[model samples]
Target: MGLDDIKRRIAAAEERAGRAPGSVTLIAVSKVQPEGRVTAVLDAGHRVFGENYVQEAQGKWPDWRNRWPGVELHMIGPLQSNKAKAAVDLFDAIHTLDRMTLARKLAQQADQQGRSPHLFIQVNTGDEPQKAGILADELPVFLSSCHDLGLSPSGLMCIPPEGHDPLPHFRLLRRLAHDHGLPHLSMGMSADFESAIAEGATHVRVGSAIFGDRA
Candidate 1:
């Protein structure tokens, strides 16, 4: 689908959720997509994108950044502590901050590099052991630790279990953000983004619906 089509979908979701126009930020997920596809997206005037891997983003985005000003990149996949500096340097925001070790690494690197992207604490709302997010019950303390480390996180993010209804997880994330005074909610994907909007998502990461299926 094209930019206009995605914008219309987001707009429709916002209207259904009683949100004013432009309240939700649409992040075009460019993970695993080639340069030509990304170029097409840029040519279409989209400035925000999401990537799942640091190495892949490093390989492609520097050139893209040089050519297109004001492009914002978000790291939306699991972040390793060793890659914290690279991630901090490349992304404008990070949506997968789940552990204290990585948070500390990011904080140190961001301070040293003199740049810090907006941080979001990822919560495993469904309590799935295999997921890479902090469990829901542990969020409070982890959030506090981030604040103590001066990360100053701005929101919460989650990937609800695949086959389950995602509304509850979205709602839980919304409440967590509110209780923590976080203003952004980076939840949902192509399938449940509309429902995520209904639960007050400020940023929705959409991949397939916008760029077609990844190879």
Candidate 2:
């Protein structure tokens, strides 16, 4: 499929969900994707990109940023403590703020750097142990700490377990956002995004659905 197709699907899904459409941001996940594909999307008017690997994002950000000054970069992958400083520099939004150490460092570094982007708490709403996120039961404590650290915990992001219905996880996230009074919900991806949109996803990451299968 193409970028237009992806946008159409998101719009239709929002309509089906009885929610207003076109409000949600579609982040073209360029993890493992070549620069040519990303460039094509950029030419096609996509400005926000999500990357999973720090090295990959590092390789791309400088050039992409120079080419499109207003382009936004979001880190949608698991981040290590060692890479926290670099991640803060590269990402316009850090989507996997799970631990306190990383959270504290991010706030301090952003304060030091004097210019860091938005931050989002990653929730293992799927309750997957292998993921890099706080458990659902542990989110409030995490968010409170993040607030204390001065990081704007604008929203929540999650990757649901494979083969499981993502709605439950997505719905849980939306509820958590409402309970916390956060307006953003960065759920959904290539496969189950329609359901995510139906469940009120404020941001959806589309990779292969836009660029075709990866090599």
Candidate 3:
């Protein structure tokens, strides 16, 4: 599927879910994709994009931002604390604020820079030991710590365990966001975005379905 196809599908999902059109942001994941394919979507008037690596985004997006006015970049991968300054400068939103160290780093950078990107807490709803997210049971405490550090996350994000039904995970994330008074839910991808929309996702990250598979 291409950008237009994904947008149309998102629109349909919104209609099905009784959500207002354009309420869900579509973050076209551009990590590791070629310049040609990435520019193709840019030329198509899509401005929101996601990247998984700080260095990769640093190398390309500065030029792309100049070329494409109004472009918005999101960091959707695990964020290392050492890269917090660079990430805070480069991304318009960060969907992977999991650990407290990274949170403190981001907060310090934000204070130093006088501005900060929108933040989303990545929750390990599946409790996968290998994943990089705050476990569901630990989110409240983590969130409180973040607040104490002066970092306010506007949303919650999660990647459900592979091969499992994602609806339950989506519902859990939505509930978590609600319980915490967070307004946004960044969940879903090309495969389960429709289900996510139905479960009240405010943002969806789609990669291969839009930019084609990475080599």
Candidate 4:
């Protein structure tokens, strides 16, 4: 599993799904990997990457961005309200907009900074108790609240319950996004990305398949 292989698979998935070439953005999740592995991917010309923590990204990406032009970073992990400001500044997109407090913080930060990153509302399609996402049933209200607060999310994201069939979850996310009129669907990872593409995923986060297992 390497970058080119993953990309070829993505292209095939898009073809099977009737999506245009390059419709799916492959976000190489670089969180928790060694810097050398990240640089290898960067050297391979992968500019779009994902990070989990604000502090870890803040520590490394500024220098990397200067080294590699056109780099885009996405925040693909749980975000705390206190770190909203830094996350806003560092990430080009944030995929875990699940709570009102975080949404309010992001809105305020966007106002102060005069620019906002792309947003994706995380929906708990499986309704897991420990996950960091809004329950599917609550999305209408949550999305309405986000709109009232001036935060217009571009899509919907979800991490299906581990070890279960992911197709159902992916289909659920697709439905939610369609119902809400959102165009992007960030609902896949390394294992189920092909299924997600079939279900209309616009973004697939691949970490180990590209960089190998975390160090």
Count of clashes, each model = 0, 0, 0, 0
> In model 1, which residue pairs have backbone atoms overlapping below 3 Å?
none
lDDT of 2: 0.87
lDDT of 3 by residue, 19-133 (tens): 9999999999999999999999999999999999999999999999999999999999988999999999999999999998899999999999998999999999999989999
Clashing pairs in 2: none
Q: What residue pairs are clashing in model 4?
A: none
Residues 65-171 of candidate 1: C-alpha lDDT, one tens digit per residue: 89988899999999989999899889999999999999999999988999999999999999998899999789989988998888899999999999999999999
- Give candidate 1 regions above 4 Å deviation: none
Candidates ranked by lDDT, best first? 3, 4, 1, 2
Q: After superposition, how far is residue 16 of candidate 3 from its true place, in Å?
A: 0.5
**lDDT tens digits by residue: candidate 4, 1-215:** 98999999999999998989999999999998999999998999999999989999999999999998899999999999999999989999999998999999999999999889999999999989988899989999999999998889999999999999999999999998999899999989999999999999999999999999998
TM-score of each: 0.98, 0.95, 0.99, 0.99
Position 57, candidate 4: lDDT? 95
* Candidate 1 minimal-lDDT segment of 10 residues: 1-10
- Give the Cα lDDT of each candidate: 0.92, 0.87, 0.95, 0.94
* Top-lDDT structure, candidate number: 3
Better of 1 and 3 by lDDT: 3
Better of 1 and 4 by lDDT: 4
